[model samples]
Target: MFFVDTIELSGLGNRSYLAGGARTAVAVDPPRDIDQVLAAAARRGVRISHVVETHLHNDYVSGGLELARISGAVYLVPAAAHVSFERTAVHDGDTVEIDAGLTLRALATPGHTPHHTSYILEDSGMAVAVFTGGSLLIGTVGRPDLVEPRLTKQLARAQHASVHRLAAELADDTTVLPTHGFGSFCSSAQAAGTATTIGREKEVNDALVRDVDTFVADLLAGLEDIPAYYAHMGPVNAAGPAPVDLTPPALADAEDIAARLAAGEWVVDLRSRVAFAEGHLAGSYNFDADGQFATYLAWLVPWGKPVTLLAGSPEQLAAAQRELTRVGIDRPAAAAVGGPASWIREGEEPASFRRATFADLADRRASGDVVVLDVRRDSERADGHVEGSVHIPIHTLHRRLDEVPAGEVWVHCAGGMRAAIAASLLDAAGREVVAVDDGFRSAEEAGLTECGSHGDGGPTA
Candidate 1:
């Protein structure tokens, strides 16, 4: 019997699959850290015979090349992908045989990227599952705008055709497994369902239910802030990412931390937002581990800038390092474990900012002047937000500081984590800031927001 195991990279909001018979398997769209893939294969008692990528991902560094090399498997990449590495280039209609009467068939589905493909896993020639990577998501198709801006419209049209083709060819019972859509920015829009099938998709998937023009228009319009770090992912994947290094960086002391900060390097604290707001090194920024640490940290920090990680414990530091490595922030310049006290000299007091709720924001607004900064994405802000708050997505907040009107800044997001990150940046820049440590829903309940609107944008952080 063929078995399929999913490797969920929850931090990245992507999943890699390992599937085959009891003895042999194939891994699809693995992440940069292949150790988890290796462990899953070990648990399944299967030998990985093929490692394949559905596309050159624009989200995380691909571990397919290295995994194939390590497992002694044939690395299959789409033929149209412009890559410098040697591999068994696959095309539409190409099939890879597996043990025990199983097979994987490649079908061209270019929408998310120029060469995106979906792989159908078959048992005895009966279609059972299709690995629709970045093409057919749980309820929507992957975004078509990641490639070239000039090719976006063309890609949207292509994306529409691709999902339709899959729906037409695949059996209604075919299990539709996708790599994007589960909170990954690769999705054209947010997808909430835990599981979905091709048959179920026909009833709900916009690409399948709507006309090409309508689907394209809505998809394009809903596209929000593309993470700044995405610019590096495609190139890294095409060039074949180097093996990940999870070795802990050398320790940093107060002197080294001070010097790094003085030199303008990022000193990130991977603590809880509440703890960070209570106390943190003056120049150190909080891209707390309790949030989408990798996405936001990589999104805001300028590429190639050295970063020193500080965490409450060694475990937190190591965990943050693993997440960062997946996004190509391969090494921490230095790392420190312990609280703010350990990070500063005896006489030095850690920097801090006030933590307030939406109710507090309302109370403070009534008594004194404050600038309300909403650091949610444009897509989220559109769903309804604080009526007149300064809107700047957290990813763009670093460069758009000047746009924030002057005053004691009270920042908030769909949740408090992103707001804490924004508050840290604003705090470090000498602005009086208060992190709204509450849900956006409370903003309306507390009369701080009037989103005469449809729904909340879920928890973006």
Candidate 2:
């Protein structure tokens, strides 16, 4: 019997898979961190015999080469990828036999990238599952704009054809597992759920339901700004990602930490939003290690700039480092694990800002003393934001700070997580900031007027 197990990289909202018959298995789209994949294979009592990549990923570095080298598995990549590494290049209609009854067939599925492919797993002549890496997702398809902008429209059209081809070729009962759309920015639309079957996606997927021209238009229209780090991911993955160094980063003393801050280096606070808002280093920015740490941190920090992590404990520091490395932010200059009290004991003054509920902000708004700043994406703001709130998506806020009017800024996002990050940025820029750490629905309930047409509020990460 053939089985498949999911290995989720929750920090990036992506999933990798382990599938095969009892004695041997295949890994699909493994992340840069390969230990988890190894553990999953061991738990299943199967040795990974092959590692296949659906495409050159644009969101995070892949560990396929390293994983294959370490395990002596055959590394398989699409023939059209033109990668610089050694691999058995696969083509459309190609098949690889894993064990007696299990085989993987490659299908050319281009859209997310110029040379993307999907795999169909068959057990004893019966189709069991299709691993649609970035092509066909749960409710949507992968955004085509991650590649060259000129190719986006062409890729979107190709994406439509790819899904149609999958629906036509695969059996209705074949499981449809995808890698890029679970909440990641790579998705063209928000996923309806975590899992779906080929038949169900054919019946309900927007890309599959619409005509080719309409699908292309809608897909292009739905795409948001791609993260800055994405431009670097393809090259790194193509060149081959180095095995991740998970050793605890060197600890920096308070003086070194303060000096880095003084030299205009990023000192990121990875604690919770509440903890960060209560007390943090004066210039340190809050990115909450609990949230989408890799995506947002990489998005905000300048590429190749040195970073120092500040966490509440050794575990937090390690977790933060793991997430950062997945996106190619490999070695931090240094990390300090502790609280504001430690910095205070070292003669460093900590900074803090006020946190307000939607109700409190509403009261302040009534007094005409607060300037409401909505830091959600344009798509999110279009889905019923508080009336009269100044709009600036969190990702673009760093470059667009000059556009913000001078005032006591009251910041908010869909949830408090992003608001805290925004508040920290504004605070670091010397603005009087109040983080409105509350749900968007609460603003409506508190009698704040809601405006804008409703549509999918897609992921802020």
Candidate 3:
């Protein structure tokens, strides 16, 4: 068996795969794009025989169907995915034999989502590895808050039970591969920068501590807010998303942008909001293309209108394009050839959006009673946050103006884009506002303490 592991690195997170015995591979929790999986298999001279979805993911759209279509691979999920996918739904004790000596068994591991499952692979009776999606993370268990808040306790119980099951069933030598890594919001405890053995995790991961109740309580503590688009992605993944049309027209110039703008295509700058505001082609809507780029574009940018991108570089253009396609936004009508800096140099000035870095935000947070506005979704705020930060998503800030403080308001998100927009909006609303440049990262790094709360509010919108 030529055991080959495929890893997908996207914006600080990763996905994993296992291939053995020539041209037969099992992909675990592939990202929304299946092309990369296919390419990886081809490079290793193997065929993808199966795509194993660790669970019905809420973070990014799943690419199981896409793999099935492109590679004729079998789609595998938990037996209770609750939807029709032409897959071999597996449950506890079910096993798929890829060869005479290799077997992958499905273990019913709930608590992330109701139907989450983990796969334990064995070769010649020796436990090779396990693919644990949300059920169990490297250092922490998957957050129970993905489901309804009222059921958090129920889910937490199930999660604890599932952890106990895995800890008993899998041996200490079993290698561990998780679906997400450090940057992912899916798991509260970040990955240990990389993959680790089950033994290593058992020795260190807090979720697997001696006491179940204590582990459960500690695991649920200080979970940051879930992204606003998390709810929107579940259905799309359940019902297989369509591929993005990458066949865009010829590279566009300034006139092309103007023409598209005249035709009602909003100029969405796929740059940082600060970069966009600092100097971008005038009339472009600031669409921060850093993280969750596709989700925001799909929700905010109106469909059926032509669009153009202002990428920071060629690499960024490709990333922006790929993310746009994950949500079914195939191709922009055109792209600015000169890039953002060129436009700035050419006198196509942008509105500079100033921001305060993590240190500055911390200073304001400590020195006085500056209004702190958290623009993340309600579920995210359920986790820890800057003590007493007002909760309001960027979308609803305008209507709920009365809720924000009249003092110097400092706005922030998990990162920075939404906070910049929130601050911009507050500034426009004639309230004193300063956007936190580093946002949550800065706050956490500065040793700012966060209060604990399981989310009680339902999904925001």
Candidate 4:
């Protein structure tokens, strides 16, 4: 039987895949770092015969072109993508054989993007699975607002129709595999389970169970803020992404790290929130390697500016470098691994901040002047927030620092991860800050924010 190997890009909340049999395979929606796809092929003892993109991705740079070039595989992109690359232009109903028994048939699933296509893998003409790039995600669908704003509703309608088409055509047993929506900003709503079948989705997916009008309305209403880096992904993918270079960047000493920060460049610290809160270089921002490091870092970093990575260990630095490459941040200008002591100069002590819980925040508020900043996105804050916190979505916090009210600025997100990141920014900017390292549900519990008797103290959605 023909087989498929899933390459989960957990950092970006998407997945790439290698599918085929008979010593030949096809790579689907590969990330900019093609080594993973190549390694998968090597493990399976297959030669990559084709590299295909379901669409010109808007969430991350696609590695299809580079993968095809490197492996000497046929590169296939949707015909309507209007990209600057050369290769096979896949259109609806076009079929290509991957191996003797495995064939790929393209179906136009316009919605995620105007040209988005879903590829069905058929073994001896029997449908086994469908690689739904951005269409018909587990519980919801890819957001329709990424493309032209005027066409949002139009695409939402198309998205609803596309999901219906897949459910109606594919067999009940046909496996449904999607590329986005595992906490990726590309999803219209949070994805439901780990894996799903076409039949299972028909029962649970809103697109399948609801009418088109209702589905479109619900999807449009529920969409979250798109990542700032996404504005760059589409054009880069359209022009064809450059090959990723994973060579370790130049090692930065304390002086080099300080110089980069002084030059208005970024010095990112990839460490746990607790470790970062304890002590870190004065100007470095904390983007914990333990959380969605790549997405949040790529979202906030000034594009094209050089970045110096500071991690607690060599392994953490290397892991973060790999994650950054996927979103087209090819190389860190420099890197430093080891404790903050190594990166902090001999004279100046490492800057440290206090981490508090919601209860501590409430107690502090009762005593004196303090500024509470909610760094979550607009949609999240709308649900309910601390009565007097300033709203600044983490992505736009850099330019809007002047707007944050004075007084001891105690910042928080739904959970501690983003709040930690925000606290670093404020601390770096010379503001007295404390990271509220507790869950938002505790807000109501501590009388910080209203909650349902009890909610997941983590970032909901």
Candidate 5:
């Protein structure tokens, strides 16, 4: 009896699984890095019988199709798979029997999207492990607003029903193994680090504690703005992502990078947002390397199109390349050999951002003039937050920019990722924005408690 489960954590913190009884294994929600999954399975001496996608993920391109193509395994999806592909679409209650006694039962849990589903493993009488795609997480349920606006209500209804259904049907001890983990933008209430059981989550999940109406309101309130590239990814993934070839083009001199850019290739700046803002290739896309870089680049850079990497150094180029490859942007037109300065000498450059430390933001907040924008998720805000700070949750900042006053506004995240993004958006929108370099934690440590610590990001002053 092989009851062992191997969880592979991708660089971006996505969890893909290889689970089975013995010789047969099932891979779920795999990223574009299929080779890593395969390598792990080979070490365990198990044959990958099926590649499964719980739903059409908007965050990262699924590699299940490509893995199936290369390994001759069956690719499995839900019945709502409207995309044209050679796949086995299972219904809400369909069962995929893996071996003599091992089986996985699909449950239609459509809240994140209309087609989302979850799986329950059955080995003996009842299974205790449920593979929740985005319907349920350790500390929160999936965001209901990812679908259509009208669908948000319906999805909320379905989401509540689905979670309650799981709570009612499954045993309390059932382990919840989810795809999205803590840092990913998929769920706001994702547990900080550890996995949780259904029993524990039922007691703590804020969305579950409230009635459906309150749940809907709470769910929608302060939801982060979906990324710019999220909409562009769904169609591409559904249609089957074009194959990625990692072999870089023949030695084109540093000058050739400009030719590639002029030829319609996009040069993606992989440095921090502040670094790019300071100075970069004028026309390069400002997709920083820190947060969700590969995920965004997949949509921003077309497959097979030339892309030049503008990273910190030669060491960063390989890392940047790997991140790009995760989402299938494996080719490099060429890396900026001489760095950003190389491009500037060629007369092509991009803008950079101005950064302020926690001390700087605190001083500004003390003046009672600067609007403190906390860009963390709503759940994080609810935990505890900086006093008197306006909450926009990063994602919704653009749509609600009018709400933020025109004067100097200090922006920050739990650490610094969302703050950087929010600051960039504000700067692009012609607002005076300063990103707090140290973020909230630093403010607390510095003993600047003008604003009580609410456990959110940092204090306003």
Candidate 6:
């Protein structure tokens, strides 16, 4: 008998897997943080015999090489990855036997990347599940634009074919487990569920339902700007990622935090959106320590720049550090764990802004006292935004700050999380900020005039 265990990297919006019969297991698409995988293997009383990479990941650093090295497991990668490390290079149709009555067969499923592959798990001769990585996700296929921009169209077409190939070759009852698209930007479309069967995907997956040309066109047209940190992940993974450092960062005093800030380093406040809006360091940006913290922070901060974390508690600091390390933002310059009152005790005045609901902002706008600032992605804004809101995506706000007109800037996104971050930035820049800490839908419900065509971007809820 064989079983599969899903390890959710919820912060990254991705999943890794462990599958085997009884005595041994194989890890698929593991994260840079290997402790969780090790813990899972230990709990199962199974030795990790092999670690596999479906492709070179572009969203976060991979722990496959380090995990394999520490466990004496065979490291297997697709022959086409062209990685500069020692490993077993596998090709399409290659099979590897595991302990008990299990085997893994590689299938070429290019699209997310040129070397992308999917694995079919079999017990004896019966197909059990397919680990589809980024090729075939829960509801849609992986976005093809993460690679060279010139190859996006080619890859999109290939993605369509690759998904069909899986549908044709795999059994209807076979489970489909994918590594991307849970919430990550790597997914071309929103996933309908976390896990599905081959039969279910065949009946519903958009890539499998549409013609190759239409799939390619829709995919290319839907891609938004990839995160800035993504540009650094591929090269780091190709060379091999260093083992993650989980040690709690050194605590910094008010003077040290002030020096780093003076040198223009990022000081991120990992608190609740509301807490951050109420009070924080004058120059620190707010990326609440929950819900896609790593993704948004990595997207906004420049690559390789030094960063310092400001958290309200020790646990918050640790959680923020763990997420940051997953995206290769290792070794924060320093950390300060306390609320705004602590800093104020050190004689620095804490910064704060007003938190308003969509209805309040609508009333203010009608009175001509507020400038609506929509900080959602262009794709999101295209879906529909508050009418007459100044548009600037959060990721680009640092460079585009000058474009916002002078007024009481009322900042918002699809929801309040991003609005709080933008409000912090605007407040830090000496602009009067009022965070519209409510859902985008509330703007319409509050009778605020709305504009923009409806797009594929889903609702905040």
Best model number under lDDT: 1
Please, what are the lDDT tens digits per residue for candidate 4 over residues 1-461? 78899999988889999999968999999988888899999999999999999888888888888899999999999999898878899999999999998999999999999999999999999999999989989988888899889999999999999988999899999998899988888988668788999999989998899998888878888876778899999999988888888888999899888888999999999999899999999989999998898999899888898988998888898889989988879889999989888997889899999999889999998998689999987667777789777899888898899999878899988878888999999999999999998778878878877422333433541
Show model 3 residue runs off by greater than 4 Å. Answer: 12-14, 148-150, 217-224, 249-267, 272-274, 281-308, 327-349, 355-461
The local distance difference test score of each candidate is 0.90, 0.89, 0.70, 0.89, 0.71, 0.87
1 or 5: which has the higher TM-score? 1
Question: What is the alpha-carbon lDDT of model 5 when measured against the actual structure?
Answer: 0.71
Which residue pairs collide, candidate 6?
A: none
Best by TM-score: 1
Off by over 4 Å in 4: 451-461
lDDT of 5 by residue, 319-437 (tens): 67767765545577677644576666455444565778777876776677777787776556766555667888665665688998667888877766657667766765667777776
Compose the digit string of candidate 6's lDDT tens values, residues 315-346. 98888888888899988888888887765446
- Every model's TM-score: 0.98, 0.97, 0.77, 0.96, 0.78, 0.97
After TM-score superposition, what is the CA distance of residue 95 in candidate 6 from its true location, in Å? 0.7
Q: Backbone collision count in every prediction?
A: 0, 0, 5, 2, 18, 0
Give the least accurate 10-residue stretch of model 6, judged by summed lDDT.
Answer: 452-461
lDDT of 6 at 382: 70
lDDT of 3: 0.70
Pairs that collide in candidate 4 are 443-448, 443-449
lDDT at 311, model 3: 76
The 10-residue segment of model 1 with minimum total lDDT is: 451-460
Best of the two (3, 5) by lDDT: 5
Error of 5 at 260 (Å): 6.9
Residue 309 lDDT, candidate 1, scale 0-100: 96
List model 1 lDDT by residue over 40-150, tens digit each. 999989999999999999989999999999999999999999999999999999999977899999999998998998999999999999999999998888999999999
Compute the lDDT for candidate 6: 0.87
Report the C-alpha displacement of residue 306, candidate 6, in angstroms: 1.0
lDDT of 5 at 257: 65
- Which regions of candidate 2 deviate over 4 angstroms? 453-461
